[model samples]
Target: MFAGIEEVDWASMKHAYGPADDVPALLRGLASADPAERERALDGMYGAVHHQGDVYPCTLACIPFLFELVADPWVPDRGDIVELLTSIGGIDLGSDDEDEIDEDEAEGAANYAMAAAAVSAGAGVFFGLLADEDPGVRLSAPLALAALHDDPARVLALLRARLAAERDEEVRLALVEAAGRLALRHRPLAGPVADWFARLVGDPGPPGLRLAALAQLARCAPHALPGDVVPVVTGLLGQLRTSAAGPGSTRARPVEPPGQGAEAAPLTLRGQLRALSAEETAGRAAPWTADLLRTLHAGLDDRVAERVALLADQLRSPDPWQRVDAVRMSDRLIGGRRGSYAELVRLVGEQLAAPEPRLAESAAQLLAGLSGLAAPAADALAERVAADPADWVRTWPDGRTRLGSAATALARLGDPRVLPALTAALGHPLVPSELGPGVARLGEAALPLAGALRQRLSEAVLDERAYDRVGPVLVALAALRAGAAAPEVLRVLRGAPDAGGERLRTAALRALAAFGPAAGCAVPELRALVRRTGTVEAAEAAGALWAV
Candidate 1:
């Protein structure tokens, strides 16, 4: 299909990884009869030719060939080819005003402009593909048409018409999102598009469609957003959950019987496992539904209170996947914005007891990062920690056991109930770095574990790779005023290498200072460090010298 590919001077062009000589072979591989070879070729095209959204001279040359591949009905993964073209054309030029274009950026801007124009030239082909028989091709067409078409009027009109006739829920959602993006890019179309979104939101169509429209309306016209947006969204989400579980729902559809319809022959054990894995991956395969809600949450960016309320409703959803999505959104909101998230934090803490261990572990990890803000979840975290076996130290897939995460979260909130887990973790061969800090936070409450901490510190002083463990151990010893640890502290200070031991030396000095007069034997080493003048180690030594 790529008749003139060899006529081009590919050797003269440059891609991300040097030469563009491999571009032709990769293009030809896209038309391969075998799907695996086509996938490998597509990965190569993205990894090198248009690496990380960069459009090089080689990328521009490949555009015509890419278009040819998309137009060929027999080509596999035509949708992916369309997406790559959109990304290459979507470079942000910053400002059209010449005064804003500095000399250094001018050449790059010109290249971006050229790539965009080249992609825009294929708008007619994309428009025709909107009606392609392949649902995937149809789904991807609206985005390319909206993003690259030169005439915004025709693009918006065609998208509106497509939305009317589209029966696929996912495609209908894409058409709505594409129309919003087109209006946002072309300001003059905002008013009309906003009106359309408002009408769709009020329609008696699928709750999913209305939710998508509501989110888009918030984006295009924030002033037009209804006062009861939170309530409207909450109600719509409830309806969506109901519909998803009822008969005739796509999500509720059972897996096709072996050898049925479009699916290939009877399944083997491995095939059935793969099918189940795909269904359970990331909670659900239909992310667009969750994505629409996320967009609406982002559109109400300034209204933190409203966002928090919506999250509370979502966290309480009967749909486990929606709860998982809410936990992530709660994390983002708590981390980025200043708001009253006590209710949100409490809701997230409730997930610590979720039936699914993965969800419960995720909730614990989130709570651990919240610091003092996680106080509302302290009881729940404490309960989780207490429920674990005294020797619970099994490793999870991500290297953190459930007991470790829960205990860490509980200890961060100053609960002493985590003492057992922290103490048990201390004796484990592979001690968690968090154990030291968790013990340190408890002050005298952790005094009972001082002997264990000192023993770990002595053992850690001999291992060079145990710096992560040593620093926190020293801090915990200093916090507890463990007088017996002074010898180990002095040994670390004296034996630590001059080059990479700056932090270790500083922590030792601080620990000795906390020991007060009990650290008199460290005087000689402290004086030597003090003479290293004008450095941080010298300052820390001087402080310890005065304290001793």
Candidate 2:
């Protein structure tokens, strides 16, 4: 259909592709057995012509011709059409009158000029195609509009208008894409642009679409997401927290209620803005730092450690919005130099016993930073960590990557109190990450106890207690030697009963295989364990058997 000037009767073809006249060609392309022929006809008509007025009736003619192809059932690609319109509209296609025109011709020329001027004039014709009955045409239209619509205000207006009237999910999504592009351009638009986004952020149409809209809003105005939108992000944070809590099955509820204003709004517009501002200032000191500090210190006294303790307990709240703000404030209060390190340590120490795993993890990280500044808090933090239950230390409830940050923090503090918990946690499924750092901290302080831990495993081969207790000890022992426990490692493997002993004993043997000749004495038993557990574990052992 779009055969360029040489392939068609340019004068007659002008109206042939117009909406009122298009029929036979569109029907032929739609019914073609060869999909490529249909695709070629569509792409050629939509993509081949660039300078619409250079060889035909003024740019005014492109309005109908382009719309015809745009409305065609076989016009599967909007991007191609967008490129076509963008190329022709971006250049001077020349005036409608060829020479000095009569007064009557001047009106025709003025009508063409009005239709051709403004980026929107070209886009208006394309946007009109969005109203076509065909879904393909509807989907393609906004994309062309997004590509060609240069007037940000008009584009935003068209989007809101379409959004209110649009019933098709696919077209609604196209509107989302259009809005995102406009937002990205950062152009001044109709007042409703922000409101439209705020509405979507508050009640995202679908999960994927909601997240995409939230991310775009965050990118555009990290600190100024409308107050109504905060609940959506806070809701996601709650989902993550609940999943972290434990594996018990509680029936899930709809993420948001069907009606508007159904949940307590998490933050006011000001609070949402401040949170984003703090995030933006993560690496730099914010101007609001002094103000933030004064506000936090308003009712509390510096001399009162109990007041600090109460503040730390707030970290354990079930309300995710509060929890998030609490963590951010803690990072500011404790990490900011305006506060004493002693205060920070005191605050974190109090929070460790708090029931919430997410809060406890935060306290652990804060304590880790404080360890280098004050040694007294180190032992205190270690004691509390060591006293915690083994399972509690095993995995974090939130989607956190590490559960025993407190143990790691304690290790960094050079306190031996954390050794028991660290050693106990070593064989658990998620224990490997905390192992290296903890052992490195244990250093020379752990040598005397290392032998005892090794002997416990050696003495208790037939006992379940030993099976449960020894794997972490083995990991700790190997780590302390800087990979020197091969001989002792081999002896344990030879002695432990496969039926009564646990998977940790086998894992211990494999750990030795990693050090090779550094672990040469354990080579034979490791090979046997490999035969038992198969090549994967055996291979790790095999590599360690010879030092390479």
Candidate 3:
């Protein structure tokens, strides 16, 4: 298939790893009889040839051979090859803002354009692959066509045709996503595509398709999104949960078996260790359908209210995986965005009482970050803490303790009921770093725990790697106005360079400031810090100096 590959002076070209001498061997490996060899080859192609989406001369040269592999039915990983081609062709040209391209970026831009054009020239292959018997190939083709095809109208037509005949749910979703991408890339086609997506959303087909269409519609033509999008999405999520729970249903099925798919990529010793570590650290795996719904929710982007509303329903879902997924989504949305997320917070709080300890722990963790916004969940969080104060010390499968998370949430909401749990956590060998902030939030109500905080701070100051633990303790001390900690706070400020980064230094300085003139011993150090201009530390030090 790679007939003229040898004629090319591969040694003369450069990929991410210098010489492109390995290009041909890698290409050959793509068609190897062994799946491992093929996976290794694809890894090399992406790792070196098109590293981090930067197209190289070797990357452009490998395009034709990649296409040949895609066209060949015998190629076991043709779908993955199609995806690689899409990545090569999908480089953001920054066409919308040509004026922003500087000289340093010009060569990369040119290479990207060349790579994209090369792939687009082979768009005919993808169109044929759209009908390929392999569902993987069929799934990856529409996106390639949408991304690389020069004729938007033809790409749209073929995608619609495929969508009509596509019975595979994954491929059908891909078709809808491709149509959205096509409309977004080619704005002239947006009106019609929005209409088509709207129709899909209203269709009586699987709720997943409708959800996909609704998400895309929110993206490409947000103005076209129906007023009832939240309710519609909520109902669709209910349907999805029902279908996923039904006997013989394939909705929540994993995309690939364990030890396969993207995780199956060849890895270096370090990469393998890191992957194993991540797997061990990650608790229970969520259902595959939860991931799909998360993607759809992400597409809603800045539509906070709608996203929150959808999360409420998801949190209420009977499916544990769906609820778990909702807890994660709530953490991101509520923590990052600004809005009245009371209802969402309340729903998340409801999960704190869930029978599943893991789900309750997840919900508690989410609430812990919300502070005042977590008020609605206060009663539930307090209940968990009161139920078993020792739960704070009891570790979960994910390495988090229940009452620890719940107590943190309660303390953040300014509930003094968590004082016992908070104090108990301080005496534990593995003190929760969050203990400091939660204690700080309670102000004088947390003064009883000041002795424990000071003891932990003393221990933390001795360990250089305990900088994260120290900073919060310093903040808590400052909030409590603990005059007794002024010496330790001064020690931290004086040894800031060895102790930690600017965070610890700032925290120490702020603590000294809270002690007012009682921390007069730190005046000279504070003055020196103030003179180190144009830094956050200097500003914080100046504030401390003024307070002193």
Candidate 4:
């Protein structure tokens, strides 16, 4: 179908990388009979060519070939190809309006402007895909055309008409979201579209359609929505608040930050901000209720206090999902400045003692993160640490990702009660996270756990499997400036090379040498290690010698 695939001067055009020469090779790999090969090709192409919606010239040129591939009947995983086109065309939905972006985001605003301009140039390809025969292709069309076109009457009529005949619930959801996104771009038609969404929302039809319409209203034309919108959304959230996962469920509640997941590529700081939206939660396979709650909160921006009140209600909900949604919402509302809204902080503080274990766990994690915010909840966290240990489900690890653990939270709250809990957790066989960092976050407050941390440090010397925990443990000791533990640090420095790998040895050296000249005893070993070490360990070893 691609007539000149080989003849295209892809080398002249730039993609995410410096040259677009690799683009054709990856695209050809997409046609491989092996499923794994095709998946890898798609992933590599996505990361390099259309990373975080930054559309390079090579990306634009590849659009027609993608369309041809999607239309090919014998193509393996046609659905995925169609989805890729939809993602590519999503650059079309990007807005160039500078006012919508933060003033500090000169780069973000500029990136969006470039992507939108480039994608909008190829508007005709998306508009024509509206009547594609495949169900997946048909569903993707409206979203692709959304912000790419400004003709309110034309796009709305097309989407609204498509929705009437659309039988698939998933496709119907996409259509409504697309219509809302389009309305956001074109304000002239927002009032009518808002009226349409409000009607769809209140209709006693399929719950999914109603929920989709509600989410769309939250995105665009929120002002034009009906007066009874709140009740309609509230009722939907109640329906979706079932405490347990549904049938055909793995029951795994993945806590990911939008598209900032580990899958596509490592995101730059600005890419993270640009990817934030209701789409992450709303379109997920489960937790539709959380999605609605987040969307409702997004549309109710007219009053911050009111938004907090709504979230506070969820925080107190008996249903675990509602409470989880509340935690997620609070993270968005009162970020670092927990003092800005003392009332919100106080109300949130109450959740640290919530009867529901998950709610209390997430709340503890939230307060632990904010400097001094946890102080208001110190007493409550103390109560948590005093209680018998419960089985807590860990969503993710602590570093490079936002993870939650009651033990981690208590450790960071700086309450003396955390000392005993940290001691017990260190002995537990299945502890959620390394207790050391949370102890380190407590800084000098962690002195009580010094003995336990040392015990674990000694265990690391005996157990090879315990070596990974060595770094965080050393960090805690260094933070305490526990000169008394210098002997243990020296042991790790001596044993790490023979017992553990390069990483363990480096961490041990860092811990022993982090303090001042009190560590002079280790100076000889530090100098010898510096000579044999790779770049990273050499840096650590040099610092250790300087400390001595």
Backbone clash pairs for candidate 1 read none
Candidate 3 residue-wise lDDT at 187: 98
What is residue 356's positional error in candidate 1, in angstroms? 2.1
lDDT of 2 by residue, 423-491 (tens): 565435334445545665777777755655555555544444444445555666665663555556666
User: What are the lDDT scores of the predictions, listed in order?
Assistant: 0.79, 0.51, 0.79, 0.64
lDDT of candidate 4? 0.64
| RMSD (Å) of each candidate, 1 decimal | 4.8, 18.2, 5.3, 9.3
Report the Cα lDDT for residue 221, model 1.
79
Candidate 2: clashing pairs of residues: 244-397, 513-544, 516-544, 516-545, 516-546, 516-547, 517-546, 517-547
Per-model TM-score, in order, reads 0.89, 0.35, 0.80, 0.62
Which stretches of model 3 miss by more than 4 angstroms? 95-100, 244-307, 331-338, 355-358, 386-405, 428-433, 454-474, 484-513, 516-548
Q: How would you encode candidate 1's per-residue C-alpha lDDT over 1-548 as one tens digit per residue?
A: 79899999999988888989999998998787765566567778878888877777888899899999899998866777887888888776755777877875676677788999999988689988877777777778888988899898998898989888888777788789999998889999999999999899888988888999999988877777889998999998888777754223222212332224426523444235535644554455345666787788778887899999999998898777778888888888888889998889999999988897767877888998987899999998888887875424556565443346677777787788888887777665556667656777787898888888778877774455445557767877888888788998898888776667777788889999999888989999999989999999999999999999
Q: Give one digit per residue, the lDDT tens place, for model 3 in 1-548.
A: 99999999999999988999999999999898866677678778878998988898889999999889998998786887998999998887665466777875777788888988888888888888888998888878889998889999999998998888888777888898899899889999999999999999888988878888887887788889898978887887777655743223232223232245655655543245535644432433323355556666666778888788788878878877678788988888876778888888888888888887778889988887777889988888888888876676656565433336787778888899888887777665445667767777788899998887777766664455445456667877888889888887887777666534667787788899999988888899888988999989889999989999
Q: Which ten residues in a row have the lowest lDDT in candidate 1?
A: 246-255
Error of 4 at 474 (Å): 11
User: 146-233, model 4: which lDDT tens digit per residue?
Assistant: 7565465787898888888877655677788888877777787788888898888778776667877877787776665566655565
Greater lDDT among 1 and 2 belongs to 1
List ranges where model 4 is wrong by over 4 Å: 11-22, 29-34, 73-83, 86-134, 225-230, 241-286, 316-319, 336-361, 375-380, 387-408, 411-414, 422-548
